[model samples]
Target: MFMSKNEPVSSPEALLQQIDTDRPLPPLEQWNPDFCGDIPMRITRDGRWFYQGGEIRRPAMVKMFSRILWKEGDRYFLKTPVEKVGIEVEDVPFQVISVERTGASPECLSFTTSTGEQVVAGKVHPIRVELDPLTGEPSPYLLIRYGMEGRLQRNVFYQLAEWAESHRINGRQVWTVSSEGVQFNLGEG
Candidate 1:
């Protein structure tokens, strides 16, 4: 059965592919931390990058320049320009996080970067659909700003987890913590 709008999509792989592949990814150093709200960051003793915004940083690995896409209601939202050591060749892959109700416009969360950073072009909003209470008919379609901030946070966690897994960095046990108190332990490969 198809998941509801409030539910997250099953596979992130398709979401990853939906990214604007033609558009060049931004350099890691050029990623603006402010792109996804205020993500607390710290330099690891080993020189690895760490996101200190939420408690998840204590256990899970965070990365830079990745993309995550999520679906909330009917709309779609994307978080990009993740900050990590080595994720992309030219530019970092942004996360396509959540798709909220349609017709809603959400603000873009901002963060600081190591050096030069690129500004995101255009605004991404969620899709919305209204159903009849009695007939269960879809109508009154309109997008609404849903959990934009929350989605961005989740995107960051997922990107880092994916990166860790790709390099065989014991990512399976990674835990994704969000400011909204959402936590998940990523499976190991």
Candidate 2:
């Protein structure tokens, strides 16, 4: 099904239809495409899509483009069966806009990305925080899918931090959140 960089082997709708309920995301891992070099696409730090020098305002189109987004090491790409085109990502590809808590005792935390994808924070989809060395500002993220991470928006990170439990680990006060029996450290409190 190899084709030119501008030609798609399957329509976006057809590719979407192939996604099973059990597997919400397309099977991009199975694709082994040739590098078609860089595209004019870029995903901003705030999660807005841009093409060339103009903003891509259509929500549907942005979501569809996100479906084909792939990352190898640190670089981002839009990949299909035939070609993989590089794209710039100012930060991570996805932004976690909202989070929901479920269950009673051992509550489960589920995150919703800006693109409408929901991922539960568990052993599989772990949350992590990185601190800026100079300013000590925390940047939190949730693993979305296929080794991609969704950066937690400021409000979302704050909400999760409020739900975190304080613990003493190795003589340091740590703030942590538990989901599906796995504890993720928010940071040192």
Candidate 3:
């Protein structure tokens, strides 16, 4: 069952502390909870959470769900210690809402997500652009964690473009961005 807003998810720090991410994830990979059936829950391509034909409309509730979301194989689920259930996700599970410059040894960019995750684009969280074959529209994604990705909102992608640098890699012109002292090639464009 989906956790309600009344649950103890008062802050993102509180949930991050529970995960203690400095350590490996809690045995979510090993334990297979009984499938509790699907719920009318979905994450839209624009990062809106919908339940029972209505928008969730609560940031805290969305952030809480982001913490518990788990992906196994090609399916996505919200898992707790005791149970798990499937949910639909259009495109990716998160949307990058903003980006800002951050101070680092050689400067870096910080991308903030709708769920309040700050992913620094570089080595671990590399950035990539995928063009839709039908529309030729470019979609940018940043690897968030554990096989999940955050798609950048249109405006945020423009913000990132301002900071991008063009470089020649392997005799081809490529665009790149640096964060966490690492450079991620955004592909030749």
Index of the highest-lDDT prediction: 2
Give the TM-score comparing model 2 with the true structure, all chains together: 0.87
Ranking by lDDT: 2, 3, 1
lDDT of 3: 0.78
Q: What is the C-alpha lDDT of each candidate?
A: 0.29, 0.85, 0.78
For each candidate in turn, the TM-score is: 0.17, 0.87, 0.80
**Tens digit of lDDT per residue, candidate 3, span 44-96?**
88888997889877676677678778887888898767567799998899999
What's the alpha carbon RMSD for model 1?
21.9
Q: Estimate, for each residue in 34-145, the C-alpha lDDT of model 2 and write its tens digit.
A: 8977867889989998887899886776787788889889999888776788989998999999998998877899899988898899999999999999999999999998
Model 1 lDDT tens row, 165-185 = 222345444332121122222
lDDT of 1 at 154: 39
lDDT of model number 1: 0.29
Model 1 regions more than 4 Å off:
1-3, 6-10, 21-189
Ranking by TM-score: 2, 3, 1
